[model samples]
Target: MKVLIITGGNIDDDFASSFLKKNHYDEIIAVDGGLAFADRSDLSITYLVGDFDTIDRTILEKYIHRPDICVHQFIPEKDYTDTDIAVKLALSLIKNHHSEENEEKVIHILGGTGSRLDHVLANLQMLKNILDEDVRGIIIDRNNIIEMIRGERVLKREEMTGTYVSLIPVTMELTGITLSGFKYPLENASSHFGESLMVSNELLEEEGRIFIKEGMAWMIISKD
Candidate 1:
């Protein structure tokens, strides 16, 4: 199942709405102020999760009364952030409805960046916790799409889109890294956090692949 989780960050309504219409998503979950964005986009938000801190009380009351939407409210002084709760809820829903054998559980997180740099960094690190899980997820913003990769994976580049692809070493001193069909290709390269080896690399062809022999890495594909 394809689940789209919209967070409370700055969102491009036009791009997000257009993307949703083009893709067939099984569910749409909005986090906090994201509900307002979803409403403006004319999208049906199935689940709303967050603390009511930033949301307008009047608007929330109207939506809460509606039977179609399932609203989950948290305390203002809660431990977890709204985005964290939304992701956990989505995982639970996916686990309940989808079979264990299904391999297409995709979680697309929108509005995950922009404001609150701490939250953004936390959300990025959250990917590490779920790296070993069955679900595949990515945090999407206007400029970049961030995802965590374990083992070996191929990343195919598209023309005029994702102009640059960068790989940041998270841990384990990423080894056996190889990049094909890119401006700067590597073969069994090892890098640390401060290394400038995997930044601002462009796609030479229509496709490329990134592989790690030992550890995991955070892949940041961006359009400038």
Candidate 2:
């Protein structure tokens, strides 16, 4: 089943509301202050996960009695962030509800990026932990969709929605990288940290692909 988790970040109300309306997922989970967005947008939130530190007690109290909502509150001193907890919960649910024959589970995180650089970086790094799992997670912001990658895979470019596709090496080096259907194609190119080797690359056709033979990379697809 498809799950969408909306967190509390810098989100444009109109855009977030519209996107939430368009995507009809199996479950919708709201994290902390994200509950306020869902309340304002009139969206039905299935689950609420977070520390409840940033949320207004009065507003949160209203939902406490709701039967459809499952609240998981954590201590502020915990090591993992609210988003991290939400991700783990989603993965657990997916594992319990679905079997091996089913399709791969998808977990989309909204409100993942904003002013807090530490939180943003932590969310980005969290993707790496789930890369090898059956669950697929992405951090979606107003302008970009970020995901972690390991081993070999193909990245297809979408038209208009995202103008630029870039790859940042998370480790020391990413080997045997091949780029196809892109303006600046690369075959077995070695990418390293502190390098602008893979930035502003555009799709030459309808789609573009990136193949990583080894190591890990963070793929950032952003709007112009």
The per-prediction CA RMSD against the true structure, in angstroms, equals: 1.8, 1.8
Tens digit of per-residue lDDT, candidate 1, span 1-224: 88899888878877776667767777899888887787777777788899978877776776776799898998989999999898888888887784656458878999888879998988898777556666787888778878988676666654334678888888858788888878999988888766778988988877787778877778888887
Which parts of model 1 have CA positions greater than 4 angstroms off? 100-102
Give candidate 2 misplaced runs (Cα > 4 Å): 99-102, 152-160
TM-score of each: 0.93, 0.92
Per-residue accuracy of model 2 over 1-224 as CA lDDT, tens digit each: 78888888888887777676667777888999888877878778889888899988887897767998988888899988999898888887877885556666778888889899998998888887667675677888778878887665565544345788888999888889998888899999898877789988878777667888887888888885
Candidate 2: clashing pairs of residues: none
lDDT of model 1, residue 208: 83
Residue 22, candidate 1: how far off, in angstroms?
A: 2.5
User: lDDT of model 2 at residue 37?
Assistant: 79
